[model samples]
Target: MSQPKDVEADLVFWRRLESQRMEVDFTKMAPEKCMAAMIEPDDVRTVHIQDIRGKETQYNLKLNGFQYVWHDMPELDGVAEQSHVENVVVPKTEALRELSLIIWSRTGATRTVTFAHRVRCLSEDEAMLANNRAPAHSVHSDFTPAGALKNLESVVPDVAEREELLKRRILAINVWRPLKTVQRDPLAVCDWATLNWQEDRVTNRMVLPHGWHELGKYAFRESQGWYYLSEQQPQEALIFTQFDSESEQADEGGMTLPHTAFVVPGTETLPARESIEIKMFAFL
Candidate 1:
């Protein structure tokens, strides 16, 4: 067997938060990830991020807080290039909402509902550069508990109905997929079940266009396990959670997952990764 074997490419963590008191300029849009200009960038480490692409049963959303699944969307290739919010994004998001309901075993129950609130369209092309977002190169969660609750206020208008949904369970989910084949800068998600929340995560303030939002950054520990899918196609979607309301009360499974984008080794010649991430919530 003399086939050309691929060389090993390792990933280093670039998520050390800029630690120090600094004034933020509110004029600019949100910085991708929590990477605002800062005083110190400390303790960047080289870590092995396992590629579990071949293992189908290793991780699932219910336990690992993240899962990779097969989905069918053939028509969205050209639609992604046009980048139409209502035309392209709305329909894809509705599909994701349906997927969320079907996989979690809470479909068509009394008051069970899922809806998307925000969507981020990322690409390397010049035409889609309005938001100026590159893949977030740091490990972080999209929402903190306070930020999720604040986001809920904007999504759910009726106060009484919001209160009723709050009584059961609330979940914040990120549905991410590549508009094309992923050539470079694949995403890596950490196993939250292995992490000690109070000891392993740090809350950092991110300045958004609207206001500041709280995001969780990681403190790298030997106990933590990180993984990334290999060669994800357009029809594949990675579903994960950023906030789980019952996280603290649980013994295992159902918690927030933190993730980041990293350069795949020897992929410099390939096209840059273009993907869309839809952030949504489920009330059950």
Candidate 2:
């Protein structure tokens, strides 16, 4: 059920009372300031983790608190190629929609899943170029309560429809898969059951690329329990919640999941990591 813990991974943690800010010049497609010092050596910690293979072990989104799914889509095999993605937006969207449906069925929730327009693909080589669109290395969830509300508004547009949608149980789920075989720099996620959201998560500002207002970001907590799946292949997908509308669910550890890309010690010679992540909204 677990792998060896001899290997350590470096993750970005938040310092107490540390104020961090970032500004991006979309015109230049770059960050206006060096966002490095926002993370300090003191803020970085090494934790031992082993990858859990979903095929061999069982993980439930509501029960085990996370889901490592075997989602194989041949249409997405060439997703790493920018040209291929750009040319096949329609097929990509359809494929993602099907993926969301599969997640909903597996969760056993009587809900409708709406695919979000925001989909991202990242590569370690491109991230080293400081292009702003990089695999997030910090330990945090994708959205806070306020951020999730704002996102819903943006997607719905109509006031009455948005309000109606808000009355139901809403969840933001991310479907993630590696573009190639992941040899190093794999993603690590914190078990929701172990997270103390109130004391562990701090609100930070995130200035996204393009002309968008600053959004809320969460900082890391040391008490969190982190896990990863070793040698995650292209055929598998990891699905987790970014936001859950139900407040009481937090007590049961089925709310938001915090995750980040971490360097797996001693795999430096392996190929750099490339992955695609798509966000979907599920209403129950």
Candidate 3:
């Protein structure tokens, strides 16, 4: 199959040497100081596969930077039925665990998968809040190395066991898919091979309702390469890594990928983007 033609889209990239505060408060709806700015009309490329049957595309995760797999769950249909924490949110968490295990098998990683209970959904209407999920428009990774370790401790709970697990490798991955066929504000991820950790990454401090934390964001660079799957359906999922414990892998294309949402220019009257992202860690 021919690859999807590259199209121009607006991507938010951080400015270097600019002293800016990136603080977002979801509860108060007031962002004190945010540094994210848009760089419009940038090209986003795509790789098209005629058929996913018995090909390297079906199993390879590290080479592609991200893998698109077919995963259909009828339980996810109830996601928009109610906004309550117990009614709609809890069931989705159960689904995430099942999804995480499938990813664990695909990666050939012999480790247990621990999924975070929280799930994130992004939409066009900023005012629309459902179960503490919101759309993140900036180009960023969800966790920093320090932040990932902290999160690991919280989830594992046992100090001794957590310490033992830390000695081994750990991978932080996000499983993302659209609630419906995605036509607007789809996600675009930078290829891992194109990233230069020292030159292209920046740390951002996030202020949430519960507490403040730090994460990494990407600054625009001419050499950076971006890709997105066109018109993704609900049954397909995009799995990409945000953090990996192997230090040597950093030089050889680390799994932590940078990504963001963008407006596909020239599209008129598109449906609002609705999607779910679940985070999980694989202990190896």
Count of backbone clashes for each model?
Answer: 0, 3, 0
Instruction: Give the number of the best model, judged by lDDT.
Output: 1
Which parts of model 1 are misplaced by more than 4 Å? Answer: 1-42, 81-85, 104-130, 207-210, 248-254
Writing each residue's lDDT as its tens digit, candidate 2 over 183-254 gives 767888777776666666655444455334333334555566678887777676777777777745563222
State the displacement of the C-alpha of residue 129, model 3, in Å, after optimal TM-score superposition: 11
**lDDT for each candidate structure:** 0.64, 0.61, 0.62
Off by over 4 Å in 2: 1-6, 18-31, 34-42, 54-57, 81-133, 207-222, 251-254
Cα lDDT of model 1 by residue, 112-136, tens digit: 2344433334434232212445676
Which pairs of residues clash in candidate 3, taking residues 3 or more apart in a chain or in different chains? none
lDDT of candidate 3 over 1-284, digit per residue (tens): 33453567667676663532344455455432232222221223322212232342543345545677676766667666546434554455445544644654544445555445334444444443224455566687877776677677767889998888887878787778887887777777777677777766765655567665667777777777677777778777777777777735473223467888777776535767777776777765
Alpha-carbon TM-score of each model against the true structure: 0.77, 0.75, 0.73
Cα shift from native, residue 66, model 1 (Å) = 0.7
Query: In candidate 1, which residue pairs clash?
Result: none
Clashes of 3: 0
Q: Top model by TM-score, which number?
A: 1
